[model samples]
Target chain A: MIEVKDLVRQFKSGDRTIKPVNGVSFELGKGQLASIVGKSGSGKSTLLSLLGALDKPTSGDVVVDGVSLAGLPDGKLTEYRRRDIGFVFQQFNLIPNLSAVDNVMLPMEFADVRKSARAQRAKELLEQVQLDPEKHSRRTNRLSGGEQQRVAIARALANEPKLILADEPTGNLDEQTGEHIIELLSSLSRDHDTTILVVTHDRGLARKADRRFRLHQGQLNEDVTAGR
Target chain B: MSVLARSVGNAFRNKIRTAAVVAVLAVAIGLALSMLVANQAVGAKVQELNASVGTTLTVNPAGGQGFEGGGEPLTAAEAATAAAVPNITSVVGTKALRLRTETTTTDTADAAAGAAQPDAGGPGGQAASVTTSLTAAVDAGTLGNRNNTGSGTGTGTTNGTEPARTFTLPITATGTAAEVDSSGKALDITSGTGLGDYSAASTKALVGTTLAEKNNLKVGSTFTIAGKTYTVAGIFDAGTTFGNNAVYLTLAEAQALAETPGELSSMVVTVNSMENVDSTKTALQAALGASKADVTQGQRNLETAVSSLNSVKGISLVAYIAALATAGLIILLIMVMLVRERRREIGVLKAIGARNRTIGLQFVLEALVLVALGSVVGAAIASFASGGIASALVSSNSSTAAGATGQRGPGGGPGGPFGGATQLLTSVTASASPGVIAAGIAAVFAVAIIGALVPALLTARIRPIEVLRGE
Candidate 1:
């Protein structure tokens, strides 16, 4: 579960203040999948960052699983992100020199997982994401865009977080590949009872989520008709 | 993966670059270790010189120097008085004599050159008339013959009144009160033993190694001096050709042979410490009544030599430090470049919940690995190079000091205290002992850690949000 209360993030541009995320509030239930659709500069990614604890808010708080993100120290914030939240970026930022399995095992290593259990867990995650068994040993840079994104998804799930925040995860893939990624995310939410939030520009992808919201002028509004 | 494992993997990501860096580092470290070994060797040599030759004083007859001055030979009474001076540890008396074959006679030119004829007084105010049945081992070379023959009939003679004669080299024979030479260095006896009592007249003599070899003599062999038979008690190696072409006899026997009983050519007096040398010299002079004996310290040549060696030691130390600093700088620059190139990797590690300490530790571990490889090769290079480098340094510096002081050249004077001092200057032995090499490598590692840690700590300032956003 996730909660956002009147979150406002401001930045100074030369002389004037710009609020990328202004007076936003929302909630998502457990096992639910949601999407936020907005144009460029509409703060869709900014809101997701606040919920993931990657950036601090100028005003208000974000609570995940009843733990407040406001004014938390750096150490505790890092632990929260590592233990409770996972992130999938638009560029699929996997280390290029590492094999797919090695990239997936990185987060578990940081979490101090047993060295003997990490490789097995990483392999199972890769299987769950439908990556080819042979590709697991290939460097991420040599993999196709779709394969790399799958490895990134597998990495996000390595620590078994309660929530996953994906900011334009399919932004760099073809339309057909993006559809498959969306279906995979939906299935992950339904099967694991994990909360999933996606920020995207594709209305078709947005319509398949359990709940749909549109961000405009730093404001968030739900679209009931578009939600399945 | 563990931070150490990851660091090891990352260090060789570019194998060519790592090899290049390690090669350069090994050379710098090798040079540093060599200089350190040289410095340590010179320091030890200086200590040896100060202990052995620096503390001794020579007392020769007043107005009796080389072959020109004529004065009364030093007597046993004067030696006894010198031994009573405060801080005097021991006193050794010597009687000098030159022996020629019975058939050889000194010509007029030889007589004028102080190669005086029979019963004529020679160096150290001793008689040169002692004849021996043993033939000379060394030839009178071109210089000796030229000096003796002149441009006359080439058959050496001042006039027809003197018979034409072939010049022959004389053998130097010294009478010592102890087993040591005039410079106080113990004889390196290679065979047999020394005379049992130096004060009692005996037929036993210590023959020089070269002289014994040329004459086909060994320990227990018999030889005749002035028709008096004596047995070789030992064969001694004096570490030089000229030094090994002589013989040593007990002071009493030499005095009996020269017919100068109770007389000594010089007395070598040992003081307890070098610091007490000047004061001891003054006291000995006062005790001997200055007019009766010439008390000489002969430390100017020794000081010039020791000063040059000290300069070499200082230079080697400075060079060692400079080389070490060069190694440190190489590590620092290489680590800085690695940190800059790996900024993205650092940001990613931070994003993945890795602590700043972990990332910094990785780079440091990587640096230590490089240094370890370099040190192995550097130690080998130092072991092979240190000796030659030290010898070269001593040779150059000692030669410069020798030139500056204009000390006596080879064969210019008798082998005495001054000769030993000159030899001490160029005899430093540089060895690369394991302990010194190990200490050197340890210092290099310490400096390398500091050099690498600087750039490693810079990783703490990288922000994941900035790196990712920039990407």
Candidate 2:
């Protein structure tokens, strides 16, 4: 469940004003599998960042799970990111020092979960991502790219967040691995009753979503009937 | 884990750097500890020496010219008045004189040989000559007859009679034997008893252990000095070599033997307490001057020498303080370098949401740990090396002085100025108190903290974003 109203995000690059996400608006209901498809420089990542509360909108409002992002304080925004939304980045930004299980347990630690329960939950999540229980103790650096991305996905789901935001989760993987990751993410959205939004330029991945939206010139347009 | 634990773990990452820093700090701490220990040991020695020697105060005659004519001995009335001053415990009167003696022999051949020598007789060859010398015989009876069988005979007689000799010796008068406990008192007898009644007329004397040993004489043994047969009543051993050369006798006996009755060369007054020594000396000097009494130059010089030594001690204190300040600066420099090298780690900790206080505490903990380690190692090393250092310093100074004066004594031999075993024992066994060790540790801690504070504050003020951007 997420909503955006006239969200605007601007960037300054050496005295030039660039509107990456300007006056953008969108809404997604609970358990919806949605995709924002756009070419390069279409503000897809910026729009996703705003919706995930990772970046503040320059103007207008973004409401996620009934909390207004535009008016939230920096501390409250960090809490929102930690507790409400799960993010899977393109590069799978897992801490290099921690093992796979430890990486998954990081968000729960930051959220002050009961210490005894965090490890168990982290282990269960790793299994959900098709990572072997034996490999849970392996450091993230020792894992393959696809395995790391799987651990990253498990870490995103550490707190069992209501909304899952994937900013090109399969962008750095091979086609077969990307398909498997997309299938896993879609299955998680359905099984966990989570609303999933993936921002990607992969048409094959976009075609699998239940709904699709095109982002162009800092605006989002719903295109339900269009397929790859 | 806590931020401090993490920082400590990170600090060990660069092992070589940490070891180098630790070694440098250890050396600095060791040097400082040695200096502090040496200073305390020297200070204690000075205090002990001062206590043993007591203080000197000289009393001079009119216009501070002291006693003028040789015959102007201090009067008994003037001495009594001086002794009456507050804090004056006891006074001993001393006198000196020059006397002459002759040589004698038992054989006619030896007498003829001595008579044939030139200047053997007085001017114009009237009779045998007499040499002006000083002798302090105990009493009239103490000088036995020269022709007695126990006395050794010379080659000639004095003025056609038996050889008569006059010897110059110092005569001192005191109330009791206890007044001469140290600095030439009655000898301590290993065997036999002390003199019977210091007022006795019989000839008795207390000879030094060294003199007794040289002449193979002990208690009850008779010896002749200046044509007098005096029985050795006791053989005493004084602790110091200088004190071992003296002979002790009662003032009355010495005066009677010297033939200088009711006369004193000097009067030594021991005060009851040191608190009023200055005022007592001043009052006594004024009284003696008013009475036209005389004093010796030795007494005056003793007073100035002690005062000058005390002033030099004050200068040594300043030197110690300057050395301490320099040690502090060295410690500070070491800590500053340590803090600067940990800046990156500090930034990383901050970015991880560590509180500023927590981060600062990590750095401070690291510094405290390092300082503690250095202090312990340094103290141990200093304790082991302090003896050698003290001996080296003292020997160097003594040898330099000896070289300048061109007076090369036995002390200038192979083992350095203080002699081998004696110098080593004195230097190495000098005590270093716990207080000195504590002060050294405290000084090192203060310097390290001051050094760490600057870099720690800068690290605490670092912003996460700027650090992450490598700005």
Best candidate according to DockQ: 1
Candidate 2: residue A189 lDDT (0-100): 74
Model 2 TM-score, all chains together: 0.52
Compared to the true structure, candidate 1 yields what TM-score? 0.72
Model 2: per-residue Cα lDDT over B1-471, one tens digit each:
343454465456467876776676677777667766766665565454334433433333333221132223445676688778767766655432222223344455334432223223221221112221112332223343332222222333356454453322222122222324322133456666666765434467676666566557778888653456778777766665434544555555555555545544455566554445667777777767755654332222222222333333344345545544554564456546655665554443332234556656666666666677777887787778666655555455444443443434465542432232223224433344678888878877877677666656766666533333221
Question: For residues B227-309, could you state the per-residue lDDT of candidate 1 as single tens digits?
Answer: 89999999999988778888899999999988889988888898997668889999999998767788988664666677788
Tell me the TM-score of chain B in each candidate: 0.72, 0.52
Error of 2 at B454 (Å): 6.2
For model 2, state the Cα shift of residue B386 in Å.
7.2
In order, what are the TM-scores of chain A for the candidates?
A: 0.98, 0.96
TM-score of each: 0.72, 0.52
**lDDT of candidate 1 at residue A119, scale 0 to 100:** 94
